[model samples]
Target: MQRQLIQPYLLVLGIALTLSSCFNEPNYPDTPSADFKGIFKYTIAAGTGVGAAKRDSVVLTIGFKDGDGNLGNDIPVPKADSARYAQNGGWGNYQIRTFRLINKQYVELVQDVNKVLFFPDLTKGKPKGAIEGTIDFRQIFTYGSSFKMYPTKFQIKIRDRSLNESNVVETDTISVPFPN
Candidate 1:
């Protein structure tokens, strides 16, 4: 009789464990912070351009938050018009760094071209408080590019109007396709 009861209990426990393992959820901060967390979803758009110059684009969606509502820049007109100018463009408070999985390890994607991401003006006449929103990052690549057919992820961080830097968040692994 005791053995029979133990078997039922074990079965129930096993089923519970299995169900929990299948659960997939976004990793976000329980409390507000300079930094936030979330799930990274990626999609690709192909057939952009013609012939050998065909290009592919990768789009990333980042769900994030900020304790203080200062996540972007308010630069006016030409970046050169203002003293706030980022290397290649008018990228504001956010920085994006990409990496790929190589031999079971993460390696940064390095190239001569600049690959930075900028956050738009998020605090335009908005009250300062807990802020939460989604940011999309997109990039276009030519056929046969080094990053065309690789498993990649991104490390992203942001800055507040007060110049407070948020903690960096890394995205999940996603695959982009190359020309056949």
Candidate 2:
């Protein structure tokens, strides 16, 4: 009876020790940082006026790290209250800039309408700690009939709740096709 009890206690202790050793807290900078992981392009049908238009869509995967884990917005600000948050970089915590290769130079492509994106609170209902993860951002482009294909890339960065901007990382150049 004594040997059986001792054996069980030892087994439990060994498991606890193993689990503790396997999980080590991550240490990272308080400022959020991001890296371009990959880029994927695909053709999707858009609109149904006469026939569906084939549009090119690209998904950019970015890896990010934040020490304090305050890398996203907890709640969306209502449209009426958006003015108040404008000073704090608006409601979006994730910022993106699109660039297209033109004449061997990369020029920033400004959209007719601003597209704002925000990431959800990463530490929702959990204790704050260092966190790292990847996010995929998708964008669809309707090219003009004048261009058949173009080389494009994007610059990505992330902002923490504290308004600290991360280092900007650029994706590899990809040839985007425009379907007629």
The TM-scores, one per candidate, come to: 0.57, 0.82
Steric collisions counted per model: 0, 0
User: What TM-score would candidate 2 get against the native?
Assistant: 0.82
* Candidate 1 deviant stretches above 4 angstroms: 1-52, 75-92, 111-116, 145-148, 177-180
- The per-residue C-alpha lDDT of model 2 at residue 115 equals 51
- Steric clash count of candidate 2: 0
| Candidate-wise lDDT, in order | 0.60, 0.78
- Per-residue alpha-carbon lDDT of model 1 for 1-180, expressed as tens digits? 999999999999999999999976444343424332444434444554555454556665666676666566655434552334343243346667777777889898763343434556676887756667777766555656443477877777665555455677777777654334
Consecutive 10-residue window with the lowest summed lDDT within model 2? 77-86
